[model samples]
Target chain A: MSGQLLVFVICGAFAVLGALGLLFFHKAVHAALSLALVMINLAAIYAALDAALLAMAQVIVYTGAILMLFLFVIMLVGIDRRESHRELIPGQGVVAILAGIGTLGLLVFAILGSFPAQAVGLEAANGGNVESLAALIFGSYVFAFEFISALMIIAPIGAMVLAQQARLTAKKTQRERAAARIEAYAQKGVHPGTLPNSGVTALQDSIAVPGLLPAGRISTSSVSQAMVDRDAVVNVHAVSLLTAQRFAELSGEVPPAIIKPEPVDLVDTKDERELLK
Target chain B: MNPEMVALLAAVLFVLGAVGVLIRRNALVIFMCVELMLNSANLLLVSFAYAHGSLDGQVAAFFVMVVAAAEVVVGLSIIVSVYRSRRTTSVDAPDLLKL
Candidate 1:
């Protein structure tokens, strides 16, 4: 075996070990670091083959961008410092172990199986590397590419909405909870420490959108407007206001602005959550 | 080693990468796994490009890396926001749809 073979063997070993480490490791940061090692090794493998394009890509995307994001998230969430993360999920630890074993088994089976035989047969069909793949990805897989774009657009919106569902509920409940907490404390006539919790931040964001929810909780702050795209702003804010108002109505406290006794054509399929007077 | 052996090793890395991303529990780890997987794919493409005496695979790899970089920027922010909201790095915890 030559130096090149030795390099390949070493890098390949790191990639496999890193992959195993990624699976078995409990600490997220450690796993992330292991993944980075695997990526670097893969790049080295690319370099050994004289594939400069792939080598650079391996560095920039895997090392520079993606792994960095994982670290950033870990940092932002304070995962390393929190005690809550230490608490094992109900059945997760056992299940994760089982799943890991199952996954390893499946991968081993799949790889050692007949796929390579079929892959070799298909090699003749490939027109070339970058050009052909690009044509196919951008052409035949255009829908998939667009789907990815759509995912990029919709994921944040979905995540924000989902994460804030409880916060949204708490806004109304907060009104009640605040009244109760305040009244309980107020009877003692000592003002309860009025410092709001994280719930307030959600409400503040929701409110910043103009007319965007059950009670128009969204404010038309320029900063918020600047954050979202112009095309989506109107639609997002519109839906938000409708939903917010509907939620407020469920709380039986209709804001007077929309409570006017006019049979306005507002109660349509569009406002699915609106309650009739 | 010959190019074929290097190609084989690169393929091995690619396969490991896929396994890492698909199986990991922690979001950070999962993201790392994704990186590993992408890099592995890059290696496979690069090795094939060289063995076939073509530059196209390398070029395609460059574009893939560019897009991957963009993905990381957005993906990280999303994960960060999720961590802030849920206070957990476990991907299982983000299943807000069930709730």
Candidate 2:
């Protein structure tokens, strides 16, 4: 077989397989991957068909950009999304497959009936594939190319407008937020300023660790109430030890032994205390 | 391969894409099938360009690719917007107009 024919056969088989995979794959991600396979093989076939520049464009544009866009959308939409098996119409799958095969048969019949016995190859017309295509694109189809440029601009703007979520409420200004906080503070004993910053110490710098108050007690407001409810608050004993050690290092004296706080296990301890009662 | 055989292959791919569009429920999958159909058309255009010994068909195919890129951007964005409000990628989920 001629080398071109060999290229066509192999790529054609794989392209068809990939297309079928696109059809039958249950996962959207898998279907996207299969479509990418089909696109790559089609680019190979385009190369065999003497559209060398087109072949490269096919790989770069379709496989590189478009399929990646598809995969991105798939991920955004949720990769684990299942393709609904429940047909919208009864027996739609069977009917669709049969119709597709029938359409393929009709196309084959038409091609066989009308196509010439031999194709006139592009060897003479293409002095160089890139130059000739450039001549055609910039010369004859230049106006169409300009229109395409317009389309390229418009499409992204349309996409942006379509995908953008309209803001439902006006954003509050800093002054407005401060006023609201003051109003709440006047009506009820609520803290007006921002909550104390989460703890940062040598032993533990986690949000679950409450910062120490100026009075040397752990500030409850520093760690969120949610953390306390979930029993995720870090023990302050270790942090106290680290602080003493650092102080001793600075003063060149032995670190004082600090008493450990009773470990707080609010939910379990409450249940245990009830059981003991 | 002969241009005719290449034409046959393109036809097969186009039909496969059509069936995929029909059978697939996910909007993203359907969008992919439409891309497959467009790619198959590009293949046919390239093959005919080879057969006729002219670069016009290839140029046409190049135009198709550009238009397809623009179309995909708009179409995918619409799909994403629909998904955002609806929280499902199923094509049938957005059937508020259906009685």
Superposed Cα deviation of residue B84, candidate 1 (Å): 4.1
Chain A: TM-score in each candidate? 0.44, 0.61
Q: What is the lDDT of residue A267 in candidate 1?
A: 36
lDDT string, candidate 2, A1-277, tens digits: 9999999999999999999999899888899899989999999988888888999999999999999999899878777766669987999989998998899889998888566678899899888889999999999899999999999999999999998978546889999999999999999978998899977877788888877655445666677755664567776655676687788899899766554444343223453232212
Provide i-RMS per model in Å: 6.5, 1.0
Best by TM-score: 2
- What local lDDT score does residue A43 receive in model 2, on the 0 to 100 scale? 90
TM per candidate:
0.51, 0.72
Sort candidate 2 into its docking category: medium
**What local distance difference test score does each model get?**
0.58, 0.85
Residue range B1-99, candidate 1, lDDT tens digits: 444454555455555555555555566666666766676566656655655655556655665676666566666666666666776767767776873
| lDDT winner | 2
Residue A3, candidate 2: Cα error in Å is 0.8
